[model samples]
Target: METREKILKAAAEMIADDVTATISVRAVAARAGVSTGSLRFHFPTQRALQDEVLRRIYQHFMPNDPLRDRSLPARDRLVNCLRQMLAPAGVGEDARRAFKAAFAAFIAPDPSEQVHTAYLSYERASAGRITHWLNALDDEGAVPQRDRAKDVRFLLTVLNGLAMERALPYGDSVLQSETDTLYTAVDAILGTAAS
Candidate 1:
């Protein structure tokens, strides 16, 4: 790989392993086997490097915007896409860790309003896919498509809540039970039987 790509890849891997580290330019340069000046040539500031890495991390999780598969059945595709988000393995543990650290940073003493804005932007990007899937299914006479936004919001809310719960203390069984509940609820809402 090229030096810039190598530096990014190395920093991404290290950040995934430990997001609390200094993650300095020299450290990334050493990891990329390039000079510090070379690394700085690509990223003039720490924030720039981190922001690029963060974008890369999210892209890795939902590449090619899998959520935009309007050709697929909405309910089924939404469920499948959501399942990927719930599990920590699909997105790479390191990227997940990096995101978590970034989230923590956002919620620290001096939070960024831009981060909140970014959350909505990212949500809309992913949620658009789910919403489109549902609308397409409705158009095909599969679903009634009433309150499509509400349906998508509810489903996403439940899915995200369950995933967060699963990641918290003393919530394994809660997570599993909620997952079962979600499957049942979604199946009924979509007018389908469990496969």
Candidate 2:
């Protein structure tokens, strides 16, 4: 493989293995079997390298994401897209395990700078993806031109709460409640809330 591709691959592998998603330049260079200078030649800064890796990761995972489906109503599409984020949590024992892993990685104790930075990077990427979806809806005139930042925050807050609920004993109505909450949030953000 070429030098640039090799470096990127090594970095991506490191991120995949790391619970905090931390990427160290020297570590990547060592893994790629290249010198730091060579790695620097392709990616001038750490942030640039991280951004490129995240962009590629998102593209690979979301190539045919539901958010791109124009056939569905805007609200439905948005709600479905949000639901996809929670699908990995499953339910019952699965959800509990997922929550346990997350807590151990991010919430059990004080997080290091690397852990904190990695968390922030992921958070920013998620917010960026949500904003992109909102922008697409706005372009289609399906959503109002409001403060999209606030809307993104609102949706993320709801998603976080719903994810936590999945791990708890919510009884048989959990799925229906989640769906209703998503639809209501989508409606509010799109300015189509029922009277």
Candidate 3:
């Protein structure tokens, strides 16, 4: 692999392996098997290096901007997309574990600029997707005319709460409860009954 890519992958793997990883330049250099001079040459600054790594970290959880898919019913599509905001990136147990690990790092208290960058990126991406779906719903007259800004904020707030709740107990029942709660809130917001 290329030197710069190696360094980036090394840093990303560090966070994936240990959410508490320091990711200091020296440490990343050693991990990547590159010299500090080479790492600096590619990264310019630690902040820059971290920023790139953060982008990769967020990539695992953020779904393909679901706003682009229009094949299904708008409500179904919107709900599917919203669910994807917190849903596993793939199927089965490993996907869930990977998502949990990635998100744990995202949510863990970290004062680093990299964490801030990753957190804000997630917010911006998810918020943009939410706004797009809301606009589509409003256009279809499914949602009553109102402050879209407020609705977007409210919907995302609820979804973020659900996403954060995953850090709690792990089990089929716990996941089902979370899913039930999420759909309940979403149905209330979008006016659909589960039954």
Candidate 4:
């Protein structure tokens, strides 16, 4: 890989650490086995580097649109689409780590422009996923003729609630129960036509 790519990879790996403590350029340089000056040469500003790292993390959490099989059942497809929002990183461990890390940055006392941008990007991506799934379901005649915008917001709210439940100090069974409940709610919300 090129030097820039190597630097990005190293930075992304650092962000993936369980702690997700502030990732400094010096630390990233050491991790990449590159000089601090070299890392700076590639990313002149600390915010620039942080933005890149967050971008990479968000990318890791994004799902592949082309890979989704639209031919699947509506409920199955809805589940698949909803899961994609969190599945790219992973379902459990990775999800926990990524969420803790990103949410920490987002809720920073005074978020920098870069951090704010990353947070907004995450929100948009999440909303887009839900909108995509709703459209797909609507296309299959599984959705009612209600206000789509409202439905999207509602689904997002439900998903966020479920994510919070997952983040709580609960057992795996609790998480599974919440997930199952989410799907049932999603099915009902979509007015699923599949029997």
Candidate 5:
């Protein structure tokens, strides 16, 4: 990768470690083995670097898959979509640490609104994917006569709620239960159309 891209990637990796941590440009430059001035030339501010990293994360989380094609059954498509969203893509200790650090930062006191906004953006991106899947299901006669958009919204809301719950304290058992319930509900929804 180019020097600028390398710098951004290093900064992203660092920020991912602790999304809310006030990371220094010098640290990023040191990580990237570039001059601090070079890092600043690429990303003038910490926020700019963070916004780019977040954007990249969002894009990776929400891929443009060909599952939307009508050739696949809606049930399969919906399941695939959900799997993509729920699957943990970040790997190894470093990435996990980054996620946890960033997560805690977002939940920390003072100027918390930005973290909330980032969360909403992530939720909406996932929701949009869900909406696409549901609409496809409707087209394939997989979702009965229900309002596809409403169903999509409800499903996304439930999914997001479950994800958040899983991230919280005292949610381990509840998270598993909620996942089971979510699958059962999904199965019922698809099964209803066949009945």
Candidate 6:
């Protein structure tokens, strides 16, 4: 592979192995079998490197995004995209394990700077992705324009709640409830009646 691709692959591997998703220049360089100067040439600052890594991670998670499909109703498309965020958490034991790992890494005790930075990076990337979807809908006149930041925050909050719900004990109606909640949130943000 080329030098830059090698560095990115090494960094991505480190992030995948790390609970906190933190990467240091020296560590990444060592993993890539490159010098610190070479890594820095590709990504001058740590923030720049982290941002690019997170962007790639987000793209990997959201390949073939539903937001690009205009054939579906706007509300359904938005809710479907939001549902994708919760899909990884699974249900029952899988969801519990995911939450447990997250707590151990980020919440059991006070998080260190590395953990905090990693969490914020993920959060920002998620919000940015949602905002991009909302923007696209707005551009197509499928959704009304409003306070986009507020709308994004609201949608994310709903998503987070729904993700947590997956870890909780619930009956067969749980899936229906989740779908209803997502539809309600999207309709509210779009200033339309719930479908």
Q: Worst ten-residue run, lDDT, model 2?
A: 15-24
- Each prediction's whole-model lDDT (CA): 0.66, 0.83, 0.70, 0.68, 0.63, 0.83
TM-score of each: 0.48, 0.68, 0.49, 0.55, 0.45, 0.68
Q: Against the true structure, candidate 2 has what lDDT?
A: 0.83
- For model 1, how does the per-residue alpha-carbon lDDT over 56-110 read when each residue is reduced to its tens digit? 6656765754435767655556566667656552233444564576467555536
In candidate 1, stretches whose alpha carbon ends up further than 4 angstroms from where it belongs are: 1-77, 88-99, 109-111, 170-178, 191-195
Write the residue-wise lDDT of candidate 5 on 108-137 in tens digits. Answer: 646577777777666555554665556556
Instruction: Give the clashing pairs for model 3.
Output: none
lDDT of 4 by residue, 1-195 (tens): 787888888887765663325668888888888998988998998867866665555446654553256666667767656665545444466657766875788875488887877766667656655655665556568888888778777877777766666656666596578667667867667765446
Error of 5 at 17 (Å): 26
Reference-based lDDT, residue 119, model 5 = 70
| Residue 154 shift from truth in candidate 5, angstroms | 3.1
lDDT of 1 at 42: 97
Distance (Å) between predicted and true CA of 167, model 2? 0.1
Off by over 4 Å in 3: 1-74, 89-114
The sequence of per-residue lDDT tens digits that candidate 6 reaches over residues 62-124 is: 678887677888888998889888889998899999888877887886778878887887786
Q: What is the lDDT of residue 193 in candidate 3?
A: 69
The parts of candidate 5 lying over 4 Å away from their true place are 1-73, 89-102, 161-182, 191-195
